[model samples]
Target: MSTQYTFEAIGTHWQIDIKDAITKEQSGELYEQIIKRIALFDAHYSRFRADSLVSTIARAPGSYQLPDDAEPMLSLYHKLYRMTDGRFTPLIGQALSDAGYDAHYSLKEKKLSPPPPWDEALIYNYPTLITQLPVLLDVGAAGKGYLIDIVGELLEHAGIRNYTVDAGGDMRHRTTAHMPLRVGLENPADTTQVIGIVDLQNQSLCGSAGNRRQWGNFHHILDPRSLTSPTHIAALWAVADTTLLADALSTCLFFVPPETLLKHYAFEYLILQSDFTVIMSPHFPARLFTVK
Candidate 1:
């Protein structure tokens, strides 16, 4: 029998099937490493997680010098700043916190209903590692994906030749079966109903649009370009070779118009629309999936 290792890692439980040569204790040790890595990533990078180092710095003023580990992600934050044309600004944390997501998912009493005002973002200096205003930063959009990347890298480095690391369903996967990973795409509107499934082998797959930021069918995939929610499209999933690409791309693609997205990203796609139609990228990995 193919041995299946099942447990929680990176905030999501997993079931990994391997050839019988891999022992249960070996799998258990691997899982232990995975959790340690998750804790490490959170301590260094997460903005929503209060116990993290970043949050500690954010809570402190008078210019706190960042540790060596935070320096790399600080570099990524800069890169993401440039790449997204300021749409993916880490300063959105202030906006998110103003909405009452402090310490947890719970928002402030007035946080839920209203929209943020335009042009309120603080000008952050990346190279200088300083902020001009009191910005409440939320890494909710990117931190989890970063965690997945780190875990996947660990699995790759440990000679776990074929493995998958999923952080709350955001996956960095590599599989061997002449096919991709058999993954179910959870509907943002109804978490139980998988809108579709995809195969992810030697690729990273992330679900961020449509069903994710939702109430009923309407959701929060707001386009920073237009500063409005996208219409008609029900869901969007992106597959790429890197977690950062998958994470950042998902935010924009889920929020903006299709034509606008085409101009922005050259990646492949599988977008589900309102009329029960599927619009896929020219080279989307449809060959990997079994439509059931």
Candidate 2:
């Protein structure tokens, strides 16, 4: 028996499953803790929130201390920023806001300029971030995945062994029984149907696309350099040992070729083109349905 908890937080929905049954009292305690932890994360990172640490950074250029848990996420961002030739950047926050995906959900586009270079915009040294200029930092690409991993760690710390932490479809699953979780890959063009299915066990899977959070001529994923969204790919997904890598790669694949990232990471991927053609790693571990 499993107990699943569902709630909305950090601009998305979260569903966590405890594969092993627990007493009602235990479940209640765990749920409370989860809610509190997610709230803390939002308070620190949510760009949409005026009270968030991200907002504080946007207000002025100064050296600010980060939470103890910020090292992993910031480290990954730094690596990805370098690996993707500045395409995948936290500095894209201002451009995204200009495109109208702001706190107001205005969905109105304004003039946009390329974000500043990563090195010039800020300096990230674990537990401390120094902003050289007033800039908006958006970590939407991998923040959710990192948070999922955080929640997963929380469960493990509490002695829960079999569980899954899913936030807005990006998830991390672990099971002592070695049972695989079958997940469907949703079709961006046709959300009512799935393009394929993947059997995930002891791994994390993340997908990204322009279908959601879209505006007149832009989606959430915008190129920091070109200041435009890629029209070639419709959707993409990645599976890796950690949700952070999977989430970051799903976004990175939009800008760089697989071979470019393959040199740095170990993972499987599937990319669906706008014209309906598919590109996937040979060992992607997913069965796709025919697209007509």
Candidate 3:
């Protein structure tokens, strides 16, 4: 038996499923708690929200205190920023806006410039993040995944051992029965069809592609240095112990090679090229329809 809760939040859809049955009252309480937590995160991180902390930072350069749980996300950004040579950066928020992905979803193209280097843009030190310049910070790459992890933790703390917390398509799954959850990998070019399938167990899987959000030859994933999205890759996915890592790496793979990240992180990945060429780790637990 399973209980499912679905809602839209943080500019995306969220679905949480508990494999074990619980009282209606318990479900209601958990749903409330999850909603509140997601709201708190969006209030601080969403650049689309005019009243968000990100907008405040964009308005001025100064030291700002973030939520107590902001450290993990910030720290991950800092690390990936350095690893990708400034390609994968939170500083790309303004660049995204300049390319027409602004707060209004205008989708209008404009003159664009690359984001400033991380060191030149801001300094992240745990609970405090100091902005060297008034820059719009976007964490669309991994913020949702981190939140999924948080919600998963919330469920675990409630003594629920078998559940899945999925935001959009990125998700975290845990099952004590050891029964794997079979997930279909959506084909980027054709949403109606899946190119592959994976049996996700006590792990997280995240995927990224340019087709999801596009405007004037640009998608959500932008190269900080070139100020353009990579056209070579069609889609990519990563599986890891934590959704945060899986989510971040899925975006990172677009800018860097799997080997470049594999040296530092323990994860399995699959990259589908524009020409349908597949590059994947041997250990990736998935079967692709395109692979004969």
Expressed as tens digits, the lDDT of each residue in 1-292 for candidate 2 is 8899999988889999998878999999999999999899989999999999999999999999999878898898899889999999999999999999999988888999899998887888868789998999899998999999999998998889899899999999999998999999999998998999999999999999889888798888998878888889999999999999999999999999999999999999999999989999998879999945
| Candidate 1 residue spans exceeding 4 A from truth | 1-20, 61-77, 109-128, 187-196, 210-232, 256-266, 274-277, 287-292
Each prediction's TM-score against the native? 0.75, 0.98, 0.98
Error of 3 at 121 (Å): 1.8
Candidate 2 backbone clash number: 0
Error of 3 at 59 (Å): 1.1
Clashing pairs in 3: none
Instruction: Tell me model 1's lDDT, rounded to 2 decimals.
Output: 0.60
How much lDDT does each candidate structure score? Answer: 0.60, 0.92, 0.91
Model 1 clash pairs are 93-136, 93-137, 93-138, 94-136, 100-107, 100-108, 188-211, 213-220
Could you tally the backbone clashes for each prediction? 8, 0, 0
Model 1: per-residue Cα lDDT over 112-220, one tens digit each? 3222322343333433345433445556666666667777777767666666666557778776655567888766557777766676788888776554434432344
